[model samples]
Every structure is written in structure tokens, then in C-alpha cells.
Target: MDAGLTPVRVVGAGPVGAVCALALAQQGVPVCVLEAQPETARGDSRTLALAQGSRLILERLGVWSRLADVTPITRIHISQRGALGVTRLDAGDLNVPALGYVLSYAELAAALKQALRDADVAVEYGIAVARIGASAAAAELATADGRTLATPLAVVADGGRGDDAPQPRFERDYDQMAVVCDVQTELPHAGQAFERFTPDGPAALLPKGDRYALVWTAARADAERIAALPDTAFLTALQAHFGGRRGRFLEAGPRKTFPLKLTWTGSEAGNRVVRIGNAAQTLHPVAGQGFNIGLRDAWELAALAGDTPADALGGAAMLAAYARGRRADVVGGLGFTDFLVRTFSNDLGPLRHARGLGLLALEAFPPAKRFVARRMMFGANG
Candidate 1:
């Protein structure tokens, strides 16, 4: 069969899968993407914060130039709710153009969709992977529509949870739901971001153009209550929790809620099958780490085909090298998000004071601030 006819299959056409397909197509490797959502389906309204490092990778894949309506993040402010702990990071201090950028899901999806068209990467809409079967030669993708696709490599980027997964994954339900929405502040964001940790959970307001995209992570009960709030009441409550740092919360758009959890495979999937993106790992919205790490996953996986023949795409050698190259990053990203969630969601007296002092120290000490800022801008290695 022609390689284009049996292209490496990418399950789930979300950012990760789309990036994977495009990266391969850019390298003259054929790819087919299976998207569960229909062409006309509405995108989730949540906004994502793309780190500086991710921008470079996207540029390499030729996706960044296609993005529209992005809001840059030049500085970040961090604090504990109603506490003296405060730390600020500026792009100038780090000597970078911007720390990050905020983008709506719809804008990003549209960009990737267009890129897919330009690259002529085949995408089958409304086709979800119901199950996967692996063999010595190819990975079998069983679709919900009762069709089967056989390909040398199968990359699963759908958010985890499948009985058909090749290996066991550790799961942690935070018992939290994130309330996402857009809000108008009395003061312009000026490309600044704020993350305030309440005893309940973490709340982050990222600059989105002139407004702010609010991601409020709270306990399930609290999230439900917050979601049920009337517009006037919601604004008041948000103002109280976030304080007046960004001035008053003038108005808000519609709000949505999504449960928070961390699901990650304990090890790599078996031969000829690989999982990347949320299928391999899902993180809390603590530091906006999930998609960035997933994008890197897509890029690394694409690099495996550099000088190798098409027949060996998912052969033992390729899969082994991929696992070795990715394990450290997977471990590091998981540890990074988990630590932020635990450290900030507590209110114990000693720990509270320690965190406050730590924040003070972070601001006072340039080296420590640079270390944390670098990690945020890049990854664990920074």
C-alpha cells in the first residue's frame, strides 16, 4: 500500500493531534487525523495560555504565523488571597519579548484546520476511536462508525480514559471544576497576568486583548455555587476573591464549568501504538502546562521520522527512542503542576507563613525569581 494511503493515524483532532499531523506533513510524511467533533461543532470557549517556548515550536511547525487574535503576556503577578505573599515576573527581567500569549480555543482550532487543508493532511471528521488493536506490523484503529484503519503508527491525543488503553494510567480527581469566562475590568490588562491562590483553589486572570480571560478553579461545591451566581452577584464575589489589584470587575460574559483531574500513563504504550497530549497525561489548570507539553510531544514524535524509512515509522527502534526522549519531560510536567496545586491550596498556619515568606524571598532574590520565571517560560530544565 502507498504510504499516503496508510498514513500514520492521529486520533483526536485537538491541538495535539493536529500539531502532530502537520509536523509530519511538513516533513513530507503522510498523516491522517481522526477528529471526534464534526466540522460545524462549536469549540469549547475556554482560553489557553501558550508559553514562550511553545511559540517557537509552533513557528517551526508553521502554525504560529497562522494564528489570529492572540493576546501577549508581558508580565505576571502572583499572590495568595488576602495574604502578604506577592511575587512579580517581567519579560524585561528575563530579556524575552513576552512570557506567554492567550488564545481562544476557536481561533487556534481554525488556524490548525486551515493549516491541515494547506498541508493536505487527511482528516476524517466525526470519527472517534472506539478501540485500538496492535499487531506486529501496524496499529488497528477501530472507529465508532464501525470502520477500521490500519496504519504503521497510531498516536492517541484524546484526553485519557479508555479501556482500550495499552497500559494502566494513574488517575487523580481533584474534585474541582474550573469556571471559565471573560470579564471586563475597569483597568486595561496591559498584557499582564494574575494568579491568586485562595484556600479553596487557584484563580488566574490572563490578559486577552483588552479584557481578561478568567479561569477560576474551585472545589466542586464552590464551583457549582459560583456558576449559579447571577451576573451582579458573580462579579461581586469575583472581585472579593481577586481583590482590587486589577481594579473593579465591570462586567462578565457567559461562564462555563469543567471538572479537573490528572490522568497519566505509568509507562509507554506497547509497540506500534503511542499516546501523546492529554491521552498520555492531563494536568490541573494550575500553570497552563498541559497543551504546551502536549505540543512538545507532537513535535518530538514527528522528529522520529527524520532519516528513517516510512516502513519503520512505528517499528521497535522508533518507539523505543521516543519513550526514552519523552519520559523525563512527562515526569517533570506532572510533578510541576501537582506541586503548584498542593502548595497553593493549603491554609495551614506554618505552611501559610512559609509560603508567604517564600513569595517575599522569590521577589527579593533575583536568582530565585529568575529560576522560577525561566521554568514558567520554558519548562522544567529552565
Candidate 2:
């Protein structure tokens, strides 16, 4: 396979795109990666919660050992504010070393980039895809600099930000904002993550190094107010809301806020262009499903492409199979996260009582709990 005439072209050099390209290249498939941003500007400060399955994928890609500042989550605690509902998920139940991991987005990106370089994959940074379309023979792409290229398959993993990317077939605006920061609790995290559902939204505290990565969800107005508070005031507010589960929050890092939404580009893989990762679906961050599902999308696509002959890389049959294969996992993840956001983020009396009972039941049933845990750690197929 010629490097210049790669059969597959992947857009976006983010975690998903990098993983897809690296996985394919490692499997003896020639792949070229186009990144809209320059290498120096690709650092992302956001924290990512990667499932155990995702760790396996990275380990297969040979970048897992290169990641720095990673914190493993051995258990997860689920509860509802002002309710009797409480459930805990432990990695020991499944005999896994950890349920998930927390690391900076930039660290993962760095590791993947290093692996790609070592694999001799061609990655052209700052080469934006201005337009992309597919034909029976190949997928055509128009670059921002007026250069045109074609490949047997074009994978759009740029989080649906490309110009020619299809409009989201399903769109939602949750009218909530997630205020994200790192906070230090008086007591150690002990490798436990917490998800506390409140009337505003769901707040997550994932153990990250010496501090906990905090995702405080709230209504738009409330989130704005919280984001603008001084460090001391913010810590006080977080302490009041998150309760004493982790003891008092002593120190805080800079905070940022992002609006919540669910966006999906449908499951129809049109022509030779297949959208995966965030380009395929973007879910609410309730259960940390979005990024991990994107990783699975990348890995599965790479595996399917590797098995298929080069001449039939982006054929209708192959694309269709990819879509069908991913439908269950993608839809299940979307539904699970959306359900949590809708069902638990409110304080309605009837639903609150029902949710409490449901949590109690889930805790009491080992098999059912294990099923859900595996689903989160892997996917619907797991």
C-alpha cells in the first residue's frame, strides 16, 4: 500500500480520529489523518473519563503505557440529592482491575500522536476539510486551501464540526450547563467516583490524581452564577450541593462551563463517507458515554475495515455492515445517558420515589448490577 495514496482518510486529530487512524495503520491499512488545528494548539485541558474497554483499545494501539497523570476509578457511587436512593458499582464485582480512568484530554492526545508517529502514519496537521462528499468509487474531499483529495473511505471523526458534515438528524438542547473544574476534598478520593443527581442536573466527581475532577451541572442561569463566583465562594457552593460525601472541598482550580446537548447524525452511512465518533452521535455527559462510545466506534470501524479487502473498503455492503454493527451500541449509549439526564435531574415527587426504589433494587440484584456495570465499562455488546 502506497502512503501517498492511502485508501482511508480520517478527518480530525482528536482522540477519536487519532485512535481510528492509529488502529487502522497498525493493522496494515494505509491511513492519512487531517487535523484542522496545528499540533501546538491541540492541547485540550478538559478531563476525560475513559472506560476500561477504551483502555484496552489504547493498550492495543500501544499508547496506554505512554499516558501520564492517569487515575483509575475502582468504584462508582450513585445517589440522588434529597432522596433515599443510593447505588454503588465496584470493579471487584466483575474481577476487573478498574471500572474506568480519568486523564487529561491533552495527555491522551499526546500519547496517540506519539504512537501515530512511531507507526509511521501520515498525519497532516492544520489541513482542514472544507467539503466532503462520497461517490460509488471514492469519497471526495475539498480542503480549505483549495486542494482536493479522494479516498476509498472518508471517516469524519471531527465531532461534526467539518463544513460538509451532515446536519444532526437528532438535536437536543438540555438548557443546562456543566461547570467543570478540579477540586480537593478534605478526605482522599480512594479511587472512587461519585455521581450525585440533583434538581438542576447530575454532578460527577471523578478521582484525578490528588484532586477530583468536578462536573457540576445546573440550569443555565445558575451555572453562569456559579462559574462567576470567586474560588472561595465556588468551593462553598459546591460543598453545599455535593454534600459531605468527600468531606469539605479545600482548594479549587480554574473553572469552565459548557452547554449540554444531544446531537446525532443518524445511523445512515451515506455512500463512501462514514461518520463515526462525535460525528455520529453526541450524548449528554451524565454517564460519561460520549467519548468512550466514540472510541468503540473508532476501534470497530478499524477492525471491520481491516477485515475487508482494500478494493471493497467503502462499498455499500461494508458501510451498511458498519452501520448495522454499531446501531445497538450507539443507540443504547444515547438512550442510557439521556435517560439519566431526564429521569434523575429533576425533583418530581413520583419520579423521585420511583428512582429511589429503582436504585435500591439495582443494588440488591448482583446480576443486574453486573450487567449494567459491564455495559458502562464496555458497551451494549459487553
Candidate 3:
């Protein structure tokens, strides 16, 4: 088969998969994306915080300008709930235009969908993947609609699967659910994102225009109870937990809940298959790094595919190279998010004091603050 005519088959139409398809198509690589749902299907309404690095990737892919209107995060604040001190990070401090931007998941999907259409990438919505098989020559994907796609490379961005594959797996269950929603507060957020770690879990308030996006990671029971609260009751509960940081919470929007866990899939070299995004790893939402890291995977893999020789596109050597390129980032991000969730989620006296002191030190010391800021804005590599 002619290399230029051969397309890459991507499973899933979530943000990660769509992003991979878009990046590859932009590089003149043909792509076929299979989505299990219709194009009009409503996506999860949660909000995502896009780090500076993620913003750069979207800008390179030509989708950031269209999303500029809805992206509102520019600063971040970190502290324990009811703590006397808070550490703040500003985009200006790092000499960047913005630390990060907050985007609604649905809006981002819409933007990427439009970009994919404009690029003329092939997308088959409402088609489920029945099975996947691969060999030395090409990978094959069978869909529920009776369509078989043969491609040089098969990238699974659909998320982690139970069946066996080439990659090693590492997982951790937090037994927590992240309850997310929007809140209207009496005081302006001033575009500052706040993260407070309590014994229950980590709660974050990210600024979005006049309102704030609230992500509270709590025990399953607590998450359920909180999700069931009436708007007035929810506000009272939120104020009690969040304290007076953003003043009193006035009203809240609909709430949603999702389980929290950490997962990582090893790289497969000789199977003519590669997994990116959620298929590769899933992180705790405390640091807001899950989707951002997946975006990096998409951009990096696309770059690798664009540069590799036609005969080597899905070859063992090429796949291994890609894996090597992504290993540091994948491991580092997973470790960081894991540590943040475990370290902050505890109320042990000694650990609490140590964490509080650490925060104070980070605020008092510019070097330490800058280092943390750099890691947050960039990745481990940066």
C-alpha cells in the first residue's frame, strides 16, 4: 500500500483522540477517528484547566484563537483550607501571557470538532469498535457498524481497557469521586484558581468569568451526599469547606460526579499499536494534569509520526522510539499527581504541619516558588 494513502485509525472521539487526529491531519497525515456516539451527543460538562504548555500546543494546532473567548484562567492560588497564608502564582511572574486557561469540556470538543471538519479529517461518529487486531503489515479495527479499517498505525485513546495488550499497567484506587460544578460567589475571583487540601480530599476553585468552577475530591459517600444537596444547602456546605477564601458562595449550577483513580499503561513496541492520552494514563484531578499530559502525548506522537520514514511508521523501531520519548514525561507527571493527592489529602498532625510549612517556605522563598511554578506551567522536562 502507498504510505501517503495509508491512514491512521484512532479509537475514541474524546478530547485526547480528537486532538491526536487533529495534530496528525495538520501534518498531512490521513486520519480516521471512530466515535462511539453521535456528533450531537452531549459531552461531560466539567471544566478543565489548560496549562501554559497545553495552550502552546493548541496554538500550534490553530485551535486556540477560536477558544480564546471562553478560556478565563490567568492566575492560581494554593493553600490549605482555613490556613492563614496562601501562595499565589501569576502569569506575569513567569513572563508568560497567562499561567493557564479554564475551558468548558463541551466547548473544547466543539472547537476541535470544527477544526477537524475544516481539515477534512475522516470522522465516523456513532460507530463502536467491536474488536482490534494487528500484525506486521497493518492494524485492523472492526466497528459495530460492520466497517473494518486497515491502517499503518492504531492509536487507542478511548481510555484503559480490561483486556490484555503489550503495555505494562500500574494503577491506584483512591476510592474517591470528584464532584464538579460551577458557583456564583459574592466576591470576585479575580481570575485566581484556588486549591485547598482537607482531610476529606482536595477541593479546587478555578475562575471562569463571573463564576468559579468547583472540583471537590471527596470520599464516595461524601461525594454522593454533596451531589444530592439542594442549591442553597450546597452553597452552605461549600462555604464551610472553602472557608472565606472567595467570600460567601451565593448560588451553584448543576453538579456532576466522577470516580478518582491513577492509571498508567506501558508502551508496546512491536504490535503496530500505540496508546495515547487516557489509554496511556489517568491521573488524579488535584493537579489538573490528566488532560494536559494527554495533549502532550498527542502532539509528541504526531510529531514523531510526521518525521519517521514511511516504511517505519508503525515498525517496532519507530514505536520504541516514540515510547522512549514519552517515558520521562509520562512517569514524572504520574508521580507528581500521585504525590500531590496523597500528601495533601491527609490531616496527620506532623504531615499537616510539614505541608503548611512547606507552603509558607514556597511563598517566602522566590526560588522555590519559581521552581514549582515552572513545573506546573511546563512539564517535568521543563
Query: Backbone clashes in each candidate structure, one number apiece?
Result: 0, 0, 0
lDDT of each: 0.85, 0.90, 0.84
lDDT of 3 by residue, 294-367 (tens): 99889988998888877788888889998999988889889989998898887788888888888888889988
Clashing pairs in 3: none
Better of 1 and 3 by lDDT: 1
TM-score of 2: 0.98
Q: Please write out the lDDT profile of model 1 over residues 1-382, one tens digit for every residue.
A: 1454568888888888898889888777778899888977766788989989889988987889988689999999999986788999999998999999999988898888888888888899988889988898888988999999898888888766555765545778888899999999999999999999888899999999779999999999889889889999999999998999888999999999989888777325346888888888889988888888888888888877655687788888888888888877777888888888888887888878888999999999999999887777777655
TM-score of each: 0.95, 0.98, 0.95
RMSD of each: 1.8, 1.2, 1.9
Candidate 3 TM-score versus the reference? 0.95
Alpha-carbon deviation at 251 in model 1, angstroms: 0.5
**Candidate 1 — what's its lDDT?**
0.85
Top candidate when judged by TM-score against the true structure: 2
**Candidate 3: global Cα-lDDT?**
0.84
